[model samples]
Target: MTTKTGDQESPLASQVDPQTSVSRVPPPETPAAVQTRFRVIAAFWAVIIFLGFPIWWKTTSIYRASLPLEEMVHWADGKTCRPVFPLEIHLSTPSLPYIEAQHLLRTTQHTLDDLNEFAAHHLRLKLANDTTGDHTGQDSSEHVNYAARETPDTALTVRLLPQEGLASPRSELHAATTQLDVFYPPSQIPVSSSSNSPLSTFIAAELQQLYGEEKATIAHILSGDTARLASTSPQLAEDISRRLRRSMKYAETYHLSFSLFTPGAEPSSWDIEAAVNEYVSPLLQALSPISNFTVDTQVQLYANFAPTAPKPEYDESEAVWTLKKEGLSAFVNAAEWPLNPSIGTGPTINFILYVPDPSQSPLVVKENSASSWIVPQWGGVFLLNPPLSNDEQGSRSNPAHLSLGSLGPAFMTFSHQLLTLLGTPSTPASLPLRLQTSIRIRAATLLLSASSTMGSLARLTESLPSIPIPATVATSVSTTLSHLTATCSHLREGRFGAALASARVAETEAERSFFEKSMVGQVYFPDEHKVAVYLPLLGPIGVPLVVGLLRELKRIAAKRKAKAS
Candidate 1:
């Protein structure tokens, strides 16, 4: 019974012990299995290292094209090109012999060179081919037709004619043409032997005076040295600076939006088409050679000023409403008024014709008592004080409709202000001359502006190394530089129109390159942000592969050591 009981306990104990026993250590891994595990890790790492990384790098890499950074900076610093104005003046000596005319030209050129303080802007005298007759009293139509065929480089035509009763030589500038008529006594004409002549000296002096302002202006622009313009009148320097400050930047086209704004409900409509045709069209036509303009007009009623704007106060002495000169800056209620820029390319110039309520019928600037004032780099404003009419309620009100005749003065003022806004010079009185001067000024301004843009773009690329430069931006930069070179060449050859065209293209391209959307967006995306984005996937995958590679390497080293021992 004891033996049977012990055997039963032993079986139970064996079963219980087996159930509670720790697991036995597994046999050493097979060489084939270890080799297989190593191959798995190697294959996994091979796919990631050789295939995945290459694809990621190819897909995520930023393409940065090469740029001419040093050249761009040189252009901005005025080292690549120095602007020069070589004005060609045609000398027409109808009354003098050809030899004498040639002599006169030589002497006059010598005198001009001596008198000129600015070398870049100097006059060059050339004998006119058609010097057959006196052009002083020529028919206006004939002169105009002749002028149309003349070379665009010809800045002026000097007609030297012998006048009987003149003791001293006198000169007259044609108002409608670029011709100068110099009336001198026949005795003043220099002989072939004479090295110097009074007539040549006089001509040189007149030409010097004629171009004094332009010379000073160009010098100021090129050098920014006021001392170059020391010979110029103080008024001229002031005018140049003022014009530069007030002028709008150069553009190929400008949108002219004429809006009639009023504080009352009356004067809701005006003959804008007729008024523009009568007053503004001619000036725009004249300015067509230099710039293009698109005209649009609208009428806004019950357009009140901003509450923050200074209201016009009634002046007891002047018997009219007056706006303080200092307060004129806040006159335009930009927030409330519909002064949105025109929907098109180029800049929009808003000309506001404001008609006050009947209570403040006649409003003017307080200081000068002028009815019009210009907003610099923007537009102009004119206060229209229409004659008050008695309504059904016996209350004075502005007329419901303004006729073309009533809008004449206001339009005239607008035209004048338009010239001022377009950077038209006040001197030389001739419209054609002023326009020509404007061409040179505009060309210089555009060239400088484009160069500055190039420099800015170069610096931007240099400062932000991670920003991707698109092929489009590189193409634009190339285009801009090429056009800039063309512009410089044209300017040197005195082809003002071509220079202006080329400069316009350069400016456009430079602006496009500098403002490239792709380049701009990439600027905000940094490398650290990219790393943060990729860390989660790379961390787990990378750590295991690295550890497996190290363990395999260690095993191979141990096997070699064991074999050596």
Candidate 2:
């Protein structure tokens, strides 16, 4: 037979001839080769699934702190709680009989229901004891807030009295207290059967006027409904909004940033501390009920005009130096002005009294010849053209010293701006009453703002999944929720100062939860890369061990077969 190449299977196969039993080499190692291949695959798989994968996982995984993501998210959603303001009005009848007083209250309530536009804010009246002439009044707390709501924390006290000369009816508002004095002619008192009466109409009008600003403020805070504030004149709406914008958000404390700005460096030091105490101390003291204030005065000289600002022009028509009203918005020169806010807990309300050089004296509003203008919620600008003084020789410098007296007008403007920025309404005259309203306004603002922030945080968490939730986020959420509860409780209790404090905490906590660090980590690595790295070391070391084991197994099997035969 012709010998075949190694490729030919006949050459490798064992053949027995008739003349002799030919022992041919067993088809060399086909079974061993297959066994070696399986063992090599098993070795790689064993290393990969058992050791390599675990180590890689351990190395690459990030530490994810336990967080109450679900709870935090839920609180942020409106599903958790709906905030409501329930105001109670106390009604006292010093002049009428108990039955007549009760009837009048009922009629007034009915009329009020007819006039109310917003349903969320409703006034409820509680009858006082007529037997004891003393209607319960709130006891003074260590905190001497004029409008402190104790004695049931009624929003307003209504005193019904009989007036002889009044043709129909009239009401007088006490500037000091939230008390409205209603004078109705004795004859207009509602009869037991009458559901509606002229007395009720008078009561409705009186109540409406008293709460008109508050209603507009609430509406603006709750719904941003400036248009609905038409009941308050448009000028009032603009004034209120301007003040609100200028005013710092409700805080436990406000940083009073009093800055004295001058074009040149001459009078760097002012009797500032004294001036502030003399002029501003009373206003601050009056505002103490709503929040605390920290005062600091800074004097910044060499404050320059912006390049784009219009230079002072001598107006022949008015015989005064004029600055265009349109140009006033840029007068602050924020770029160069050192009116930085004070560093602290509450917002920095900057009070800038810019002293134009003596050369630019008698400065007036170009359009109106006005001496002063308010910078919305920012501050006020008052041109202090001090009367030109004569030296011993009767000559004056190009500019004059900014007297402590000149700062009076500027400070006054600043005070007005400060009030507007503080969200103080314009109608109420008494300082204490305004502060009480401010307390309520701040409380309402804080509540609504925190709620909206919660909603935003909930949405943020939902939209992004890769970010890890830290335990701190959960803690912050719990803090926010608890504070929110406290704030609401304080609001209902008529502890607005306390409510604002709680709401501040809530706002801070909510912000922390929303901006939690380490929440986001990138995650994308290829599996093929891991396999290529691990396979090289495993392949060479695996072949021999697998082959030896397979050979031993084969020898054992042959010996067992021979013995059995």
Candidate 3:
């Protein structure tokens, strides 16, 4: 009803206020506020760049010590060291004049040099100097002992003697020592003007034949080319290959554990101590020069076979129980047997003497009726078939305790097995020479093994960039290389004992460096996992900071454009 101007104005004002509320704009930001926002963002980015990033990098970076990678690789590739064997032979001609001895030595050396095909192995003959000068009735051993103390490089001593009515020259190698006795006619002695003689030729040929197997074996190991060993027969090569395949790796010390495992309760105890002393002690003593050994014995009864193993079947034709040849691998009940290795740093060779129950007495391999077998680098096993006897109740059973006489055959087999496991060659009949061969073999094996480990470590570091290499590993590598050098030098100089010692050090250091526990931790924590862990925390904070920075940069750019216009 009141059509006044105030009422009309009020309604329009209300309509205008609604429009203004719908389309309103805030006030422009002051330069101080913009500068403050920019400062805040710049400060945040500065903290992240200077403090947080450095802390993260410092905490996450891996330590990698500088290594002689090239030198290691060269050594592994056989470029740094070429192994050589310089065997020294002493000529002890107590029955001949010095001039004649020197002439014979010259002729023999000439012939030896001509016969030797492998340059890596050469023998040098030196005349023995008789310092005592009293050769009336001194034992040969005494002279040998004195010479040994004088010069340890004497590999073999040749004692030349003139015998009565000898048609030709003949050599007899001493089994109890490292001397070769040669008997020849008095007229066969070489003159100084003579370039060669029949006696010299015979001695040279004998020496060559004696070291033929060793030379071929070394050639095979160094080159792996059987063609280089043309002097060796195919059968001999195959035998050497098989022996190498079957032999255990080199170690400074070895633990020999003799255990008597039986399926039944009887035959629990054995004369292991006496048997070992009789059969194994001499071998261990002989091998002490190459490696140290610790002997231990134990007895386990009622050691049943594994459930998954094949059961022995009774053959009526043979009237005995037999195990399948293929099933011998599972015959040892590892779970039930207490054949644990002895506490030591080196490997343990376990020899188990298993006795079957009365019902399954005289167990033999079905294929060939063999009673003993080798586990191939593990150990040996012997099946003991004791003579059955009647108990008080007239029940036939195995003896309760094995006597020393009853254990003789088994211990002898174990001794042979031990020698085989140690990679002893079957020739020359001289135990000392065989042991010397073992020393060289062990040195070579350790050198190659350590070299292989070094190569593997180098490749591992290259392939896995994230793995941390500790300083200890570096030190170990250095030690290994140094010892490897010394080993090579010792081998070149024919000091096999020193070579073995240096190689032991090399092998130990190489193993320690390659098996470093700290190097394996990074393999489980990868870069993707790191990204996943950090993304959530960084994403929320990073987005706002980045957006503020971009906006500030755009505003400054626009202000500069305006000023330029």
Among these predictions, the greatest TM-score belongs to 1
Off by over 4 Å in 1: 1-26, 130-152, 389-395
Candidate 3's residue-wise lDDT over 51-159, tens digit each?
A: 9999999999999987888888888899989888888888899888877888889999999999888998888888886343565576999878765544446688888
Could you list the CA RMSD of all candidates, in the order they appear? 5.8, 7.6, 5.1
Question: Regarding lDDT, does 2 or 3 come out ahead?
Answer: 3
Q: After superposition, how far is residue 248 of candidate 2 from its true place, in Å?
A: 4.0
Per candidate, the number of residue pairs that clash is 0, 7, 0
Cα misplacement distance, residue 10 of candidate 2 (Å): 27
Model 3 worst lDDT window (10 residues): 1-10
For candidate 1, what is the TM-score?
0.89
Segments in model 3 whose C-alpha atoms lie over 4 Å from true places: 1-25, 130-152, 304-327, 341-345, 356-370, 392-395
The C-alpha TM-scores of every prediction are 0.89, 0.75, 0.88
Error of 2 at 558 (Å): 17
lDDT for predicted candidate 1 compared with the true structure: 0.87
For model 1 the local lDDT of residue 35 reads: 85
| TM-score of candidate 2 versus the correct structure, residues matched by position | 0.75
